[model samples]
Target chain A: MAHDIDTLSGTEVSRTSMPEEKRSDHALIEATKSGDEAAFGEIMDRYRSPITNYLYRFLNDYEEAVDLAQETFVRVYFAIDRYHTQFAFSTYIYRIATNLAISEIRRRKRRRLMSLTGLFQSEEDTQVEFQPPDTRKLQDTELVEDERSQIIARAIAALPEKYRIPVILRDIEGRSYDEIAEIMQLGLGTTKSRINRGRGLLKEKLQHYL
Target chain B: MSDEDLQNNEPVSRLLGELKHVEAPSDFDFGVRARIAAGRPAEKGGFRIPVWLAYGAPLALVLAVGGYFALNSFYSVGDANVPVVALNEKANVAAPIPAPSREVVSAPPVTKPDDQLVVKKPDVVSDSNVVAVKKPIAKDKNAGGGSIDLASRVGRRFHATPQIPAKTVLDLIGAKGSFEADGWRVQSTTPNSLAERSQIQTGDVIESVNGQTVTDKSTLRSNTPLKTVRVRRDGKSVDIVIKN
Candidate 1:
């Protein structure tokens, strides 16, 4: 019930009245460590969507990002014993999510290399052929804006991971520099710098369309 | 375009707005709660085994027994079994008959030389076919002549085997794995170029490229060599090509 109020939009909402909710992250963490499933669940319910969105933006693939987000929660759950109240709960969760994302990216890269070989071989042999679907008729009904969205998604994908992550967090997720730094475990200056650089890279890559 | 104009750009604003509406899956809350429930540890006052002793004592016993059996099995697997039996047999033979002292046995025997040399090396010494001399090494001048240092011999034997060099590739373009919070990551691979062609489907773990193990995406991008790539796909080995 307390989370219902906290979930409302705008910065002016008061947090002092909800005593149970007002309990510091440390209290919830201590309760969770003592086998209090409800407290743990409360934490999960509160953070899950934001964390999922964070990962989704970080990783363009919806399904994979969702899976990693779930794994991040699972890890957080299991590592509850190791949770120190010294750091913000957000930082801890973000660190776990970021690690999983990084691992997934590495795995994807390896797969891409293997797939590239298959592509080349298939191209040269021509025997292993895949027929292209007829797109002309479909294109007639599709909106021009929808096509533009597809192009933009591709352009975003084309940007290197370095530039991409900050852009997603800053622009797409609309997180402040302080939040981004905490999530990324970087200094405030570095976080801002990355956002700037990321935007520059995106602009340059998308300049052709612009 | 000016900074002011860019800030008010409709497309950018629209994109950001659209991104905000990207809701998590319907089961997201359920999944998270389930994980949290599963991960919650038992209460300290709750009826449960002590965490350390529960794991520690059994682990210690296992290591001790394991070490004993491992050493025992390693040494006892071969001719050691036969010698142990032969030693037991010799003890049985010596038990029944009192053997004469070495001084008396060494005295010039009235019997034939063959009968005098009855104290032969035990028949159980079948390991190397090298005869075991019962006398002290100082008395046996032939001991040093035929004996070889086992360590030096083994070392020399392996020295002849050629060492295989690890190969590496450079200048590959791909996402890097990092622990850093703000690191970039690949969101998805659209059906395209090197990624699609290489049969690198989603969720494949890239262990290395051209024999070079990559730590991060930058390392992967910079160190990817123009040659064959080695990757693990579905827990199996796969090779990919990198066109020069």
Candidate 2:
């Protein structure tokens, strides 16, 4: 198990501990390209949780987030040959995940537009459909935490997609502004502007929590 | 401070950062592996058709059917334009010379005296020779002199008046005659006509024109210019070349 600190943003680019393999993302991708299925599985193990979390915050639905995260890995696996190493693997994977999330959001909008239940409700109502069913009992503290989490999730989801993506990547995913710009295919100034606008919007909604 | 510094230090960013991170489900790796093993979704059912081909195939079929029928109707109209004979009481058989605005009467095929000269109608007719005939109408004796009424009366009389040795192929090709059974017995020729210029006299019986034997049912193609007239004169068949 080896660890590498990413200098640009102080995030961990390496796994916390894995006894069998500790290859870098580029090395693992090259191994996957050479028909190493285990290398691809390791790559999936490294990024899946973070990608799933990012999508969950973006969509405010756990099930859809998991589904899109899996789809992201599948897309990366099949299109690995076309993947250029000029961009970081994280940027490439995040971009794939972002596009998939946006597409899922649009699909949900179209479905809601056509459904009777969705016709009269505000855009906030779109979050309910793909929510993973939680049947387990919750203690008082956990319940309180869950309620606050839902409010924060809803506030983030309510932001317009342009602002939502950059805000989620910056604050929640801890991606640097340069990386966010690369993932969004936007200029640095525009990415910073959108992140500020998103924070302004979130500040109004989460004033109590702040 | 700059917007970037404010965005970085914002309390909203801290709150968002403090929120709980959602992890992928425990079976997530298994699910992805299973999906990869299954390959891309089976195209709904084994195969997929192109959207253009699906819609275009039916559209092309409709166009083909419509075009075939449209072309068929046009050919039918062209077939109707061909000259056909009208039946008469006497052996006076020839294509009906039409009156204006009248329905053309086409006859059943008539047998000729010389069976070799089939009396069936010609498949092509010149625009000048194309005529339409209608069933004869009773003349209105008390009709006033209005142009429409006058035309109706004239057409009625023209049909009612009995034909003498009826108009023959010779009549269509600039030779007006009371065509007898033997040949076209020349009644009269207009000045500078093919008959008159060919030296065909009133009494001379035309046996053939351009080597085709003349009969009551025999027809000369109106589109073709008359070349020579074979007439029986003084107990001899003489072929006379007609100048154009």
Candidate 3:
């Protein structure tokens, strides 16, 4: 069934009684258009980490993830004139981030394939993985935590793009199936099935850890 | 990733229940905000001024003022006896000799800076004369057009000052997540850090530090570098050298 965004957002217009902290994302976005910079700041404050973390899971590199996340918001700010308030702001932000991540992955793949020296590199070394430069030393507890994170990250990275994207959005970021479907621009049933298949693949990789 | 969140007794969900939340760096919002503000077009008012005007007006004004002075000077040079002098700035030459006049007048020899065209228009009516007149056509590297001088920060000692490691301890506070069930694993090593110098790699399971098994958490201490570490990398036990 098609979502009646006009009806839903119209209902949200009556939410002015809510406190500043309790104001909806739609309200914040609308506020941004009327020359309210603080409203835009609030929007960034709310979504920056979620979007950054989502991109981090997708790209595996925190720096690139942060960069893309910032780019996403920059695009949002510049194009606020064109953005219709009818849609959910969360869905809009996530869709922008998802597109950026997928585009970057394709770009990196093209760059890697075009490099002459890369032809001589080992297949394992050439695999695109999220391995950020981390030099900080940790004790046992933190070490164990870090180790688990790396294993999970690697397993997710190993998943094929079709499965990896949905899996990361579902498990790591906890995005709903409907939102993932909208972001991925797929049928609702297909999104659920892919998430399930992705979970099965993740289970195989993570069986030993559990 | 809780089993309930998945809406069934799913084993994968149970295992993924402890999945770590990715925290954006504290500076994340600060950066995004700066970009947003920097990218924001100045709010459009009732009247929208063309963007080119912001830059073009000042440039046009400068050219207008410069052209006015140039034209004024060009018209003021009324003497037909004076010859135009073309000075090759790249080459050095002595004071250019003037064409002889009917009356031999003794005046102090005026020296002008290089690249300056001295159009010595001798005053026929009075003793005074214009010496070393500027042509204003620039030929030097300092000619202010499209050229950009790159200021490089290479090898300036104050700039070369080594960055203090933000990390307070030598103890690895970073990703320790690549380990197997029993031993500490090396996920990665930064290019010039102690880990890379010690020959650690992604799958290297650190078995011992200073010949002592890693079962002891105190094996790593602040500022006390380890020596003779052993790693089980690629199905073989190898000694890793740690240079302080």
Candidate 4:
């Protein structure tokens, strides 16, 4: 029975990988553009987690990041006709995600300007939703792994946009310098420099806890 | 620099690695896939209601109304200033009546056809003979032969006005809007055209034309007058001539 279960899971994994790995992003994109909604859903399912994580770091808000990630994929779905295969599909999607994040940031800034209390309201709402129970009890109850993860997320959220983006893409998303350069629309040299700088900044910011 | 320093930084790298594995919400994939499905090309496609029309319809209506008033102000002379002359050939009478510098300001009072000779000089041009005359005729013939109607002349002037030129670059990859890239350059003007004549450089970044903001190279090319181009060159704004 154990062997059968293993075989079933392995077969499922292989079945999912078969279509995705065999078909290039370009092929999926072409299919999506031609009105194959399933093709786009497949693309989204493949990249959604990384895109969401990237946006979460950029926005520092889970709900907003999720919304933006959804928006990014939606935009990608419509704009597949314009997607060129010159760069990796990952680079293309990251570029779209980054642009959306920037626009969201700008929009938040505008909203903040319109109403001073608006900024605090969003934070209050997030806290209401994501706040833990009483500190001492929470600490006692929380798993070590979960606590460590939460601390890491908070540290990431503290970094500036320029540093945070490159660091998140390089370290978190596991993207290479060339891919990062294409996504950020910066030169390779600049991309490497930014990544190094981002890491250094993150180290400096989080040195106390570590 | 040193192995000690590198070792100290290892925790940061490890933490970053841990952060990489941060699990997104369970429904994230489902939500994004749904959105992607929604954004997919409609199975049946043709010219749809423009996105801008939905957003800008109110602003467009307001502008259309304002534009009508502004145009009317430029062309409309007060009705009182219109000249009125009455010729009663049937009455066997003609008056070198003072061409009332002002036509009757009020609508004509009720009057019989024979009594319509009452040319209420400055108030109304009650011509018993002609009905529905709404324009001023040039009394000075030498100004232009056969009394060129001023209203008609203005109408022709407005009618002959050229439309603003524009071009659109669709199906672009990498770039979002028109001027999203530094190296994304466009040469819009034809050689020796009005744009060229005005010394509008081919590679110049068009910022605006006639107070209208241009967001992309296509907008700059199409909306900018070939005769006048406002461009940003070497970090300075300048207007150059382009021959139409």
Error of 3 at B104 (Å): 70
The candidates' DockQ values read: 0.15, 0.30, 0.19, 0.23
iRMSD, per candidate, in listed order: 7.1, 3.5, 6.8, 5.0
> What is the Cα-based lDDT of residue B227 in candidate 2?
57
DockQ of 4: 0.23
Q: Candidate 4 at residue A46, lDDT?
A: 78
List, residue by residue over A15-72, the lDDT tens digit for candidate 2.
Answer: 4333555689999999999999999999998999999989988887677678889888
Best by DockQ: 2
TM-score of predicted model 3?
0.45
**Least accurate stretch of 10 residues (summed lDDT) in model 3 chain B?**
B146-155
Please write out the lDDT profile of model 3 over residues B150-199, one tens digit for every residue: 00011122222211111111222221334356566666554434455456
User: What Cα-based lDDT does every candidate model obtain?
Assistant: 0.47, 0.64, 0.55, 0.52
Docking class of 3: incorrect
Candidate order by TM-score, highest to lowest?
A: 2, 3, 4, 1
**Candidate 2 lDDT by residue in tens digits, B1-244:** 3856674548888888988876677899988887788785212223544556654676698799999999655423322212222223333255345334332223223443432212133213222233322211112221111011111223334444222122433553335676676777877764444456557777778887666666665433322234577888888998888643
> How displaced is residue B119 in candidate 1, in Å?
66
The DockQ-based CAPRI class assigned to model 1 is incorrect
Error of 1 at B144 (Å): 63
For residue B219, model 1's alpha carbon misses the true position, in angstroms, by: 62
Native-interface RMSD of candidate 4: 5.0
Model 3: colliding residue pairs: A136-B173, A137-B171, A137-B172, A137-B173, A138-B172, A138-B173, A146-B177, A147-B176, A147-B177
The residue ranges of model 2 lying beyond 4 angstroms of the native Cα positions read: A1-21, A116-145, B4-9, B41-244
lDDT of 1 by residue, B1-244 (tens): 3445445343553454464334567797676666556655322223544546654666788799999989655533432101111111122122222223222122121323332222221212111111221212111221111111121122233433111111101111222222232222223332322333455545455544455443322211111123444656656867776321
